[model samples]
Target: MTPPTRPDIIQWIKRAWASLTTATILGGFKKARILEAGQAEHELSHSEPDWKALICLLQQGNVPVQTIDSSKDIKQDDAVEEDDEVVNGVFD
Candidate 1:
């Protein structure tokens, strides 16, 4: 079989995105809550099957993925420090 074109992959991704409902997305959050509550074997319902298919297709196509390290973008100077000096005489 021939490889899928760029447009075809985009269409598949679009279909997968459409299949992702609010309930389906919120299911992940619900699972996190369940896990926090020390419950196991919680059946999280995933409504987006197309996303799995799209991922398989991308893996088969050998698509290159770029990863970002957000920590590298952060600097110590960016941290906000509270001022300890009190200006009570100026107000009085």
Candidate 2:
């Protein structure tokens, strides 16, 4: 395969960072969490950039993906004005 261009490499790294962080935040203290913690720690490391961390993620290929279902629902939510506070949380 053709070598990835510099831009592609950078894009991949950014995507990897976002994905790793997301997995960590949602996965908590599972194996993915451990991996995410380590990966992020290495990335916030220096001035130039950490290509090694991205390469490691790509090489290891065990990042757990959290499946999120796309959804949208319309609903009305209200309780009451308990102590005369303005009910301005949503526009009716």
Candidate 3:
């Protein structure tokens, strides 16, 4: 695979940072009882561009993270695509 360019890397960093920030805030809200557990989990899970590998990359790069206010909400569209490989046509 071809290596990503500088701009590409920067974009990924921005997206990853947003995801991490959202997760952090939501997690705190859940712990503090400010938000319900299911609501927190759903918001955290649905964040577009949320990638575990990106978080590791940021840590490896020694990026310092700042906490965001839990009262603020981060909303983004779903990033995942439909998968035809998940199932086949079933008998009627």
Candidate 4:
């Protein structure tokens, strides 16, 4: 399969940020690392994309950031993605 486009990666990060809390993002990052390491250890067919680097790009302002208010109530459905699927369950 072809690699995800830049826009795709950006969109995924944006969605993840919006849907997940900071703690959740941290947890996911840990999980992502584990999954990546497993792939490397087994010599998986897919290339291992640098997920932490992608997150760093987000932090460095490659994508626009939005401020959300914790005081206001949000719709549950809107607050999270229907599926918590990451690219290839890690980075595609």
Candidate 5:
């Protein structure tokens, strides 16, 4: 099979980033509720600087940085075509 194209990689990154941001927002809300109940502050595993560093690394590698519009839904066709290979490569 041919290697994934640049558009495929960009779409994959965008989907992954969208998932990451959604999870982060939900987690923050959960933590806020816990704090309101008088629980101790929840420590974040990843800090803002860590995320920034990740973006910086991507930019340094010449990856185009595109702003995601959370208001719009990402179409199914825009998702990575080589999902299994990409996911396995990242995890394994």
Candidate 6:
């Protein structure tokens, strides 16, 4: 996904149903052990990216300050991509 726009980000956040969007995502970040969380600004979507929200989540955990590029991170997942779309339950 190119990066959700700001408005989309807010919506995504609301849809996510997490009290603290940043805290939750960052908590996941820590659990995932993303050593160098890339610029938290580069949101999941390109247009209306909610980097601000992402930043809050990242702050919840003390992940490495390495800056993990989104593209590179997915490459390391050890999963298969079909038509550029990740197969559901692939990890299972």
> TM-score per candidate, in order?
0.31, 0.24, 0.25, 0.25, 0.27, 0.23
What are the lDDT scores of the predictions, listed in order? 0.50, 0.48, 0.54, 0.50, 0.53, 0.52
Q: Candidate 2: list runs displaced more than 4 Å.
A: 22-92
List clashing residue pairs in candidate 4: none
Residue range 1-92, candidate 6, lDDT tens digits? 34444577667767655444545665566568652456343335433447565565557555345654556533433545344644594433
Error of 4 at 28 (Å): 11
lDDT score of residue 75 within candidate 2? 24
Cα-based lDDT at residue 83, candidate 1: 49
Better of 5 and 6 by TM-score: 5
Q: Which has the greatest TM-score?
A: 1
Per-residue lDDT of 29-81 in model 3, one digit per residue for the tens? 55766556775253344545446644644565466756755345332322223
Model 4, residue 25: displacement in angstroms?
Answer: 6.9
Model 2 clash tally, residue pairs? 0
Per-model root-mean-square deviation over C-alphas = 18.9, 14.4, 16.6, 18.6, 14.8, 12.8
* lDDT of model 1, residue 67: 70
Clashes of each: 0, 0, 0, 0, 0, 20
Model 2 per-residue lDDT tens digits across residues 1-92: 23445577768877765555533533553364434544444224434335665456545666565544324322223333345456577433
Candidate 1 vs candidate 3, lDDT winner: 3
Model 5: lowest-lDDT 10 consecutive positions: 34-43
Best by lDDT: 3
At residue 90, what lDDT does model 2 achieve?
46
Model 3: colliding residue pairs = none
lDDT of 3 at 24: 82
